[model samples]
Target chain A: MKTTITILLTVAIMAVGQAAVAEPVKIGMITTLSTKAGYLGEEIRDGFQLAIEQEGGTLGGIPVELLVEDDGRKPEKGIQIAERFRTRDGAKIFTGIVFSNVAMAVVPKLVREDVVYLSANAGPSKLAGDGCSPNYFSVSYQNDNLDEVVGQYVSDAGHKNVYLLAPNYPAGKDHLAGFKRYYDGEIVAEVYTKLGQADYAAEIAAIRAAEPEAVFFFLPGGMGINFLKQYAQAGLNETIPVYGPAFSFDERILGAVGAAALGVKNGSQWTHDLDNPANIQFVEAFRAKYGRTPTLYASQGYDTARLIGSGLAAVGGDLSDLEPFKAALSAADFDSVRGNFAFGANRHPIQDLYIREVVQTEDGTFTNQTLEKVFSNHVDAYAESCPQ
Target chain B: MLFFVEQSLNGLQLGITLFLMSAGLTLVFGIMRVINLAHGSFYMIGAYCGATTMAATGSFLLAIGAALIGAALAGMVVEVLVLRVLYRREHLDQVLATFGLILFCNELTRIIWGRQPLFMDVPPWLGGSIELLPGLIYPIYRLAVIGVGVAVALFLWFLFSRTRLGMQIRAGAENREMIGALGVNIRLLYTLVFGLGAMLAGLAGVMAGPIMAVESGMGEDILILTFVVIVIGGIGSIRGAVVGALLVGVVDTMGRVFLPSLFRIVFSNAYADSVAASLASMAIYLLMAAILIWRPRGLFPAHS
Candidate 1:
């Protein structure tokens, strides 16, 4: 009777230990995977998949399960989906959102739930600033970080009498302000076009009339594509050089913009052509799997997965241990696609930003080629304001 | 003076685009009394066909032909299969059915083309800017669009006024039951009218392909604008569509360009700019509201 009781106790203890160590890590990815903004989410999801595939379907030594739900680019939908993942799926680590608005919706709830929110994209400034939570970590740079670098590049290049264009929105204002903070040149004119306004003929006409030395814009997604096409159509691309952040010149958009995007300088932290072995492997594998060059969103997604994996490995997959897990995540010991990636005090990346020029490659496909380093070990502007 | 000329031209170009979209929508709603929320899907289909054919054949003319035929045929099929039944039903039912068709079309597009936006380049012959005035330059492709819109409008006018089909269409719009009782094949007329409307939408899509990103749910973006244009122009009148399109276009363009600067004279630059931007976006809606209050049936009510 004594032997039987001892054996049963031993079995119970072993089962508990196994549950702590071998329970498959479930990560819930809430993103805009459908509608017009679906492409962004698609790229991010593909990158996340690629990282898992590269790791042989395991993050660290533990098996990882990814639960993906489409937010449809709506904040309400994102919040609902994230809630489902938390309650139904028991997902503690959440990742992947394309829009900052969607991120703003769910991140607070995620923080309150004591879940680790790994932002692959949509690093809104609010989170970077005083609202920064210890539970939240952005694998991607803050929204203004790339624009800041572009601004600095424009200033350093000595482009005088520059004109700025952006959609009339809070983000647009933030982007222009970020640029103006670094650029010491004369802003000949500042134009805020309507959000989702396709035709830019009037704006183009104004640009021609002004005839600034250079033009900078912060139009992302379809807006950027439309503006660049119209800019080229208006014959402005020939005389006036264009500068923008990498969001407007990413690989997904280069195909649509085609030759028009050529010679345009944009700032980014990661490019496909980075020399690091991890990045080289990632780019080649991504191309082989997806049949196109991965955008910066994809790179960020891949990095997010690896970053989480590093943390998981350090803690031996015991995510229930919160303090040690956070510390492990902050360590960021993975080989990043962007070389020399490290976390700042705010838990956003402090990495090198490069000025990338859109160029037609030998194969005739347009891609962004790294021109020069703009900011090295660049920390986000709001990091100091972050209490965490 | 040059800026004024250029902006006016820009406004005119916008008007033409709106006309192409509104003409078909107005026709469908005016004649059929069948609310077609899916008309925008035909526009999207036209764009997809244009882009695909343009890529396959490398000929803009061939792409245009394909777009028109593709959209018209798709319209005819949908009419025969789905919209035919809705003709006898209430407007609410028609709207619900057509809205479902919009969702269906969007999903179908995504399934076929994937999520990436297709790029359609202007043919080399129409790629450059034309010297409109001494200092002002406008895109040749945009001018081509204007020309096409004008040509189509004239052709539509001729169709309605001079031709037997036009007379029949006018008669059918007036009294569908009367035309049906007078030994006319009402079903065939309805199909033809819907096909023609779809064709016009396709033409607009083909023309817009070079300018805008061709992607899924693109139809929805312009769908609301087309509705506004139709509502302002008088639901079923082609003349109303033309006038309304031009008015809305000019107002919207001018407002976007000049409002902020005009306000800056009175208010602080920052406050003025933000307010102006918001007001400019609302300018068209405000105009529509005012017009509706003055003339409840729109600026040119077709039936009256």
Candidate 2:
């Protein structure tokens, strides 16, 4: 009887020890998965999942549990998901928020709780500046970076007068401000339309009357598609060249906008046609898997996942204490798809921005082709305000 | 002067689209007494069907036909399956049930079409702009929309005033039980009326599909405007819808274009632009309130 008891105890001890060593790290992804902009989150989630799957359901040779939940594009919903992830599921790592408003709502609270929040999209100005925290890292460009590149390009091209248009919202104002920062040109008019206004006839008429040498608009998602199609239909595209950030010129939007987007110059950090080895591999694999070209959002997500994998490998997957993992993450020792990518003092990306022109491929599909390097080692305007 | 003319035309075009939407909503509410929050869902459905058909056939006219038939059929199905019982229920219950229908329809579209917004191109024949004036160039499609809207208004007027079925529908609107006792098939009439209303909404959707992103929930934005148009037009009056739509459209367009310039005369350019944008969106609501105060029942109350 005593021999039997001893054998049972040893077996139970071994089983408990094995379970502790094999426990997977939890990474909670709170993203917008519904609404007009749902595709943005879908691409990000797919890209991130692709990275994890490439690692055989692990990151940095350690098993990980990726928990993804849709926020329905609501800040309140995002906060609820974050709280549940932290308190109930014990998730220490979080990523995948597409919109800036939800990011602002969720990131500050999560970072304060000693959890790392890696942003796959939406690097709002506030988070990049005075509100910057060590626990937060943005794998994507700052919200204004893409617009700033276009502004610089437009200015360099000697366009003396430009008409600016954007939806009337916080991000809209931020984009116009970013453009003006680098654009040394005359602003004929600055117009803010109602958010979600489908019809742009009034705005188009105003643009024609003003007759600016060039037009720069910051409409994203369905708004962009509407503006581009109507702008083309109104015959404005023939006389006045148009410029914008890359948000509206992604592959999915290009398919929707078709020839309207062709030849339009937009700003982006990465394109599927990027020649780097990491980007090449990523593009091919993504297209093979999803049967669609990867957008800049997908690149950011894939980079974010790889960055986390690097941290996990450095710490040998031990997350009980976050200091070593934090140090490893700060190191940023990963091959980014965007060549020469690094973290700024505020933990936002300091990388190259390229001017990409939309083109129809030989196969008759619309996609972007990188034309010129607009900015190299570019730091965000708000990064200087960061205490770090 | 050219800018003013173009802006006015733009206003008229917007008014026409709103008219198409409000006319249908008013008819359903006037004749059937069902407050359908799901009216927008039908609009969305029509756009989806139009877009899918456009992709498959590459013919805009066929797409329009598909949209009309699809929306009318969907409306009849809803009338039979869900709305027939709601006619006897309270307004609050009707609102709740229709709201649920909107959710179901939205989800159903998402499941079928996927989350990505679908694209529909303007028909090639009507693709370009024409010079309305020496300096003013306007899209041929916008003018076509205005033409269509005017044609539809005339048709509705003739149907209500001259046709036998129209008489029954008008009489039915006056008193549901009286029409039933007078040997009309009230159930079939109600279904037909609902289907006609849905068809009008579908026409609006097809017209809008090429201009806007044909995506899920695209209906809700215009739906709010349609509601406002109906309320301002007298809930059950077609004439009210016409006048209300034009007034709202012109006021909205003119306000957006000229309000900032007016404010700039008094305030700084920056301050003027911000205030103008805020007030422009509010212009329609402000108009509704003023109208309600002046005429407690809309411009042409059909009931009284």
Candidate 3:
């Protein structure tokens, strides 16, 4: 009887030991989860969780542990979070950041410390270009990529004398530059407003005076909502069409802007109506879980998680083999929601960008409907500058 | 000439909005001698109330009514529960407590409304743009804003100079203890005065709803500008607030519109733009500084 009891106890101990060995792989998620920017971060986190839940709480056939931290939209706070994740948590995989400047501040430190940094939302140009790292991969498009597509489409559609508006900042300047790269037509006026400027009446008056064929803007968040509301109120929506990147007009924004955003065309890598299996599943699952349609940021977040899963699976749940892990990530094997997803040499997304029009669904809800593909497996212009 | 006229109208529209916000702030400080840092929270509450009501009821007028009532009620509640305790306290205590209230209100708003901005549509009747000049058209809503601001200014003037309550308020501002001893219910008066100030802020919020994004923290941004206006106009002076609001608004709007072009005369377009952009934002502060240098007690000190 004593021998039998000892054997049973040994068996129980072994089972517990095995379970401990197969503990969920931990990944650090540093994203803005407070303030107005918190919405973007929350959506990203939700989408990411949706993907994990769809995989039955496992990534790459391994139970995954996600350590989420709020950066409060501060770069230094992001750095601090990254440090804790790296040193204290021993998390080798990092993903999810909403702001470009925050990501810019946090990414280099993570990459230098040998952590695989998967960007879910922000795709700063510097990271995509000369500062590209082998360990760093962005599941999101480069900041200028969508703008470039929009610029091309605008030029192709033969819109002459377009007025441009963006905030006075780096991302804003990048957007205008990206637009100018393809748009050969004369820019009637290019105006930069103060960042987070609530009133756009003066700018609207200027736009009306310019009488451009079209107006392109890159105001995100509340600024976009304010601008669109004022633009619609000024009766410019009916006559002068507005064009922007998906950042300006997405599912999240369209809902807030209501009918005002309708008929606005935006360039994007993913929309809710994409005829792709991955996207359909993601959109349905996201809506079911979050009770709202997924925005571009959400899609990027989902893709980042899925991409990490693919890489982890290929590496056989081992990130210690740096070459194999990097190769696995670079293989870009995941079925992307954007449909034809690949990575450029710079490790940013090389995917089709669609020209999506804001249209009302059958249920009176406004959402982005894909009009046509603007670019097929589009590679960013910064690849030449990237060494890796 | 057409450009200048259009810009000026835009400036006036902004000025009127600022005036609505500053009026409440100045009045509250004048009568209560309470530094209410959380005044902006009332503005946010008003905008939220208006936007939510507009969305639910689809009546623009109802939205305005809801905004005023909601903000005023909220203000009275805060005064009874919080401000009543701190009236005799130091300014620092009031500042700290109100600052904490700002955080609480912001978080509460986030929980109630969620993080996404709520939209308030311009009423159909007020949506159309009028031809202010032959070639230059301006939105009628903006002109309405100016009209509302002017009317409110006159109403405030009357309230200050003619009414018995106005006299009491002025008397209270002059000597709170004296007014208390003169058979006036000080607590009730304070509550009523705070409610009035909050209602004015709500009016500004509802007015701004169509033109601005009705979201959390929306009040704080404009609050800073309102403070600047009040300071330039002379703290606690309604007439000073009006003058300061217009001055700051016109200067800010015109600076934004023309500074880049003005700089382009000397520098290249890109260089001029970056330089002018910074200066344009700072232009209001510059004006404030100039005003201070010229008149240390502001343009109109209420005490004087």
Candidate 4:
């Protein structure tokens, strides 16, 4: 009975997928869907899936088959998927990478394969800097670019003393360095917690003692959740205000932290409650389909799918024609939900930044409301750092 | 003072959770001599099932009750099918098998629930935060977790000391053949004990859902800290697990807080900045290394 059921399910799945791909161009979505980062990957897949499905399985007059596969969040596994997509799947273009390590492993191969990699995520500094590849383009900005924005926002807010805190990872180090680059603020304290360290009482106490005017952090995922909740519980609000990147309070974290995220000033490239027809359409469509606010990760994924589709249309889906595809991707001609995003000289998106406020809806669902534009057509520092 | 009291309470609350996880893992290892990496998988399963059941039935108590029972049943099913084979095998074999179980659980979760995180709400009765000290509110649900942990610890202590089944477990731990010779149903005992450990793990999961997001693969994320507790509290000893959990909870909290500032005082500001950052991150692991070096057998080794 089990075997029979399994076979039946497999057959059904194959037929549904094949029917979708029957006429449209086939694009392979090499992503992680069975590990720690799977939730984010799923959100990405949903954003793309909804877009493709709503377009009646056609993109730019081509029936699009997004062949989804899990990389298991392993670098080797990601490389293998890339290989399979190029050799076996005959994939012309690729998108969807959540981890920087996996992106690093796949980029060199994408260069060799001559496949235009429209990176929806994984904005590693190396790709934006000396290691920039002509075949590779990032729809997402550099990781530290957000930190640099945080630097500018806080410094311009006239806060002289700021404490920098992050998990003691390479990303944390880069983020602190990024913030320090633009802000001429006095560093009263800079602390790093272990990755996956949920408890932060001691850190909170230390912050309380040091008494910085402001605190900026770059914690993401569950670590961010842990930090925000604990910081609030420790009564640091009476002492210091917190400021940092927007990812900590993205749509994915809405109900888990509840009202704790209110008043947390964040630097965001795009948010759900932005005042634009494209963003309005994106958020409404996303909400209508998924019954939830689209996270920036999801927004990026949607933009990525649309961007890749545009690039494919530019080249008529022929990856072998490198010059057209490269030029098309470099143009960054897509109605991004983040508003007009165009590629800078380094082939990374140069977009506006907004200071968003976390507001509660009537149903208690949380969404970001853009309060003010922090930076317009902001190009990252790493772009100038890149000679290319 | 109110803030300190609240954070310490929070620390104690977190310690309660670590205790629940450590209790289950220690028992499975101490007597069964099985390295079940899938232990956290059961916890994940419980959280998923409990939250889902609650969402479906709209009964939070029923959801938690079902969570424990569901986890135990799943534990037994796994023991019967896969774990029974690895019982007498080498530790490496057990590790490999359980590691495979972790992967299976992860994939199975993705297949069953898509890739999105499920929102798990605490029943209205248990959801709100409390103020043990003025202006220092702690979540009421977290304090309840501490209560549950204490109750479970007492129940376990009494069961192991007085109950006949507990005596059999003790005997089996000392000599498996002797218990078998005494006409104990050794296979069933193993099955029941595994189930009980799984129930504890599930309880921790069910309680933690509202506090943390219920997503696939969260088991692996927290499994490391649970293991750290098990190692610090000598493996298989409940008391050791409890003490070890407390030490780890406090040290981890303190390290992340204090280490960076201490470094800033002793060294050049920039050098201290980097050094303190790294050291603060590693403080708990450093503490673990120090403890292990001093006491190779752990602070309290249970003699089975």
**Model 3: residue B173 alpha-carbon error in angstroms:** 0.5
Off by over 4 Å in 3: A1-12
- Segments in model 4 whose C-alpha atoms lie over 4 Å from true places: A1-26, A50-58, A62-64, A156-160, A233-240, B1-14, B49-64, B120-144
Return the interface RMSD of the candidates, in order shown, one decimal each. Answer: 1.1, 0.9, 1.3, 3.5
What is candidate 4's lDDT per residue for B112-134, written digit by digit as tens? 97665566765678755566666
> Number of clashes in every candidate structure?
0, 0, 0, 3
Tell me the docking grade of candidate 3: medium
The model with the greater DockQ, 1 or 4, is 1
DockQ of 1: 0.72
Model 3 TM-score (2 dp): 0.96
Candidate number with greatest lDDT: 2
Q: A9-127, model 2: which lDDT tens digit per residue?
A: 99999999988867799999999888778889999999999999999999999899999999998999999999999999999999999999999999998899879999999989999
* Alpha-carbon RMSD, candidate 1: 2.1
User: What TM-score does chain A of each model score against the native chain A?
Assistant: 0.95, 0.96, 0.95, 0.91
How would you encode candidate 3's per-residue C-alpha lDDT over A1-388 as one tens digit per residue?
9999999999999999988887678899999877776788888898889889998988878689999999999999999999999899889999988889999899977798777899998988899899999989989988888898889899988898798899988999998898899888988767888888999988887787778999989998889999998898888999898899988787767777888898899998888889889888888989888899999888888988898889889877787766788788899998888889888889988888889999998998889889989889888888889994
DockQ, each predicted model: 0.72, 0.76, 0.70, 0.27
Which numbered prediction scores highest in DockQ against the true structure? 2
Lowest lDDT block of 10, candidate 2 chain A: A16-25
lDDT of 1 by residue, A1-388 (tens): 9999999999999999977867688999998878877889999999999989888888877689999999998999999989999899888999998998889888977787778999999999999999999999999999988999999999999887799899988899988888988899998877888888878888888788888999989998888888899999999999999999998888878887788788999999999998999999999999999999999999999999999899989998887867798899999999999989889999999999999999999998899999999899999888999984
